[model samples]
Target: MSAAHNASYLSRIKPGWKFGSLLVLSIGLYLISSWQVLLVAFILSVALLASARVDLKQLRAPLISIVIILGVVFILLGIQTNWLNAVSSVLRLLTMCLLAYSVSLSTRFSEMLELFQQVASPIRVVGGNPDQVALALSMTIRFIPELKKVYNEVREAQHARGLANNPLAVTVPLVIRSLKIADETAEALDARGFDSAPANH
Candidate 1:
């Protein structure tokens, strides 16, 4: 399980405020060209995450992946431009990713749903349904974890059979199971009369 699923003081903050803060920081960091400033921001972000009690172990894989990717990008940028610019760009990206992860770790799914609905509300005036949009967003978020679990389970079964190197060995069953889940979900929704509901006036 992820540290994001746990409750914390950061989770208790208003979603709108948190979103705004992250947006401002991301844009500000992106526009700045100073490697020193970006480095400081990354360090401070790590310190802030520590104070907020996010598990460093839970984040290790993602953090390392980001570093590896950035290292490649930095090498390319350095060859094309200069070392200073490459370093600063990588720092900015690292800072933005860290802050974004921090926000996700602290936020509840319900809070995320409400935030999406609020952001989507303007679409209502343009004949789009904010409620439906928010529902879709929430469902996607909820199902992603389930889908990951299913994929892992399938992968393990294939590995046990010594078919791990076979692409079809993993994907065929995954696709079939995913389709079955979708069908079941549609049926459940229909049984609940969601499809039969009358349009709002």
Candidate 2:
């Protein structure tokens, strides 16, 4: 609420500062964290989360997903015969989840497209189709949340009918709906000019 706090939050929201810090943190933590150096990642994640200026409301989905994943991971890890390995597995999963959250919080869709374009340049020179590749990536990014919502709706409907406990209750409907969406999207794209052009390469 104070002016100093407000200013610091605004400063952290700047694009360049966020990207530079993420780059350094990702590389540094990735290198050292592989050797079980948790402090490096812990420090970086703490700093990144601290600097975040956005509303926590925007983080609801990721936070919920992380909680669900961590819950399942811990349950599975508990069933593992090796206690040390189980603990390590859970810790590593949580750490990776945190780092991914940091990246998502700081990065924008445009930045993601730019990064993917640059990374795909070499493959594009080869036999790859960057346009289609980018399209798929963007579609996946956009559709995943939509799919998740659809899944939740379907699951809730199933639960109301006493089928939620059934494994098929959740998966079969999700897959069927997703397939329908994919097929319709492909048909629409083809109806346009997506795949009409002759091969350039």
What CA RMSD would you report for each candidate? 4.1, 7.6
In the predicted model 2, the residue pairs found to clash are none
lDDT of each: 0.82, 0.65
True-vs-predicted CA distance for residue 117, candidate 2, Å: 1.9
**Candidate 1, which ten residues in sequence have the lowest lDDT sum?**
1-10
lDDT of 2 by residue, 87-150 (tens): 5555555565565555555556565457657766787566677777778877898898989998
lDDT of 1 by residue, 22-123 (tens): 999988887888788888998998877876777667688898899999999999999999999998898889888888888877777567767877887888
Candidate 2 residue runs with Cα over 4 Å from true position:
1-107, 196-201
Best by TM-score: 1
Q: Pick the candidate with the highest lDDT.
A: 1
